[model samples]
Target: MDVIARAGRGMTRGQEFRTVVDGAWSADPAHRMRWEMSLAFVAASEAISLPVQAGLDIGDRTPMTAMLEAHFGCRFDTTSVDLDTEPLNVATRYPVVTAFEVIEHLYNPLHLLLQIRAALDPAPSSRLFLSTPARKPGFLQSPDHFHEMPRRSLEALLSRSGFEVVRCAEFGIRSPLFCLRGVRPLLRCIFEKIRIYELAARR
Candidate 1:
């Protein structure tokens, strides 16, 4: 599939992996793991235990996608997709698939998950990786996200879509002192974390 890049609601343009992660973003190496990039990647990576020649990446390419390429020792394929509108019916079923911080942007995350189940390799060892913000109070949530699901809600949706959670974990992006900074930090203490899940399609 050809690359299709588009900006968000008011963004001037979409940013690529080079622009968004490697170039524009940096954190102190010492504590970089506290960043969402490190947090999401670590969680997803640690859960892997399979060989992959090729894979599918469900969202736009990003640093995490690069890491997946490294983890699998091969380049994963990506398509021009608008998860909110299009069904992800790829001709090839992938052994590994990733959707990093993307599902929350959709109005119907379940629709996309169903497509993913269909698109993924059906072997028990095949994996679908996903990451998104955990539930938050309305004031702490991003305006663009139409669905900020609690853990159970997300699990239920995935289950209904023919996937079963194999492994999952959550980690915060805030510094240790963040909770002491202000009300927002205290709030972020709970919401700034990202939860990552590894799933296997049901038989």
Candidate 2:
């Protein structure tokens, strides 16, 4: 399957394979329930998104970051560093928005998450937003991905790192076959239709 096609299935199914061969449909409801509570809290509060410090262009040119900025009317400061490099926080840089998309590409997700947490300015209301493929199969499909993160494992990692998940949901929608002529919005519409499993965490 192609990248998007593979990503579509991997995001939803990859993690369940390791935990239960039966299927994700049976296992994800409980996971989603936990995420819902986390998300509701974020929706009620005003929190900033974290910026991408490194690895630009991980997925589709940072659509999620731009969307959040537009929607929330918040500006973000970005830093660039590899997973192995330590994050630099200059006096001029203070980020409330730290967004990492397609981060399954990183070698150590837990370490990266911790690094991100440490880099942020300590505010009780500070929040972080993260999304990764639900499992290893999704990681394998992407040339850059180093690991696939299952829902439960990811939740544990976030919690251990002092984050409380607020919302989580599977994102993606199957596109309809055949496009009408002169409709430029078809792809955009399809993408907008894509459901994302989103999570909001706060310390």
Candidate 3:
């Protein structure tokens, strides 16, 4: 097996952790847990429990790829596509996990979302793990953010492409002092149970 595949196997065997980074890591547990869950979900679904032919990390860049490699201890068969220069509408070697504050940076969120949707395997079990900033005060912290997306806009984009949003919820820490200030976890739990975010699955 190649390094990427071997690394994937190691991760599936519970030998190493996995992550995808878009920025420097914060000390916040909520932030860390959010990414951890996203990675674990993708890894478990494809690499661990089932056969994942290949995986794509769209917008593959230094920080994100570094995080993925460090945590997973594997070099995924990654594609570093920048939407401004090219399209990502091609078959990948495995399932995809586009995580850690990536979608908002895209110049064309819907276009890229469609590109990912097109690349999925026809099998209903194939999955994509996506994380984007929910509409909130801290969501616009980055100057590079092109869009401040709410649940409705994200759902519409995913629905139009043929993906059924299987899970969608905001996860973040708004204030360090007060635990009650965190609304993302509560909201996400509710959505996950009711299948509110599952609308983007292929339908």
Candidate 4:
């Protein structure tokens, strides 16, 4: 793990905590969770328009980068931060950041959010788009999830991190497999049981 100074703050720290939440990018592409997240990625791509965007997830295995580049002509960066460091010390800033189903895997999600907020472009139009599991009674969240979040709690966290909740809602994903190609199905899935949050920096 590398130790480096955080951007702007100038505090030296070790590398981010290491973990592999979703490693099987190729072994089983038909998994329901993958499809659901893919739908979320598509929805986020369509809803947010930025010339450059960054993905903070661990691995760049999916076609999300390609899709965004092809559709929006956006430059995408999968490397801006060291994933082994705590609270995400970003090396660059961007107009938009996408962390799909990532916060739930963090032990200090709030800290990460704050860092992301700091790394944002700081314009009202700059945004952070993220998704995580919605906490529900008797719901079986993934084992990798460190903390499942309810909608209100998530909104509160965003507010505390200096972000305004533009849109935060729970959606259900029934047919995660077939919904990846079309927008309507993805939109329907977003309105179902899955949790998707689109937030804007307060600026």
**Could you say which candidate leads in lDDT?**
1
Number of colliding residue pairs in each model: 0, 18, 17, 11
lDDT string, candidate 2, 121-185, tens digits? 56554556565545533312435445555667777777887677655555432234322333653
lDDT tens per residue, model 1, 51-89: 576888775555555666776777877655656567665
Best by TM-score: 1
TM-score of each: 0.76, 0.53, 0.59, 0.64
lDDT of 4 by residue, 1-203 (tens): 13332221112243243233233532343335544565455565444554445544323334555554555456566543433255455566777776665666556667767877877876566767777667744334455455777777877888888888777655554566656968755654554355676778886
Q: State candidate 3's TM-score.
A: 0.59
Error of 1 at 72 (Å): 1.1
Off by over 4 Å in 2: 1-63, 90-95, 136-140, 178-203
Model 2 root mean square deviation, Cα atoms: 12.1
Off by over 4 Å in 4: 1-23, 26-50, 53-61, 79-89, 176-192
* Candidate 1 error regions (>4 Å): 1-51, 177-181
RMSD of 4: 8.2
What are the lDDT figures for the candidates, one per model?
0.66, 0.42, 0.48, 0.56
| RMSD of each predicted structure | 5.1, 12.1, 9.9, 8.2
Name the better of 2 and 3 by lDDT: 3
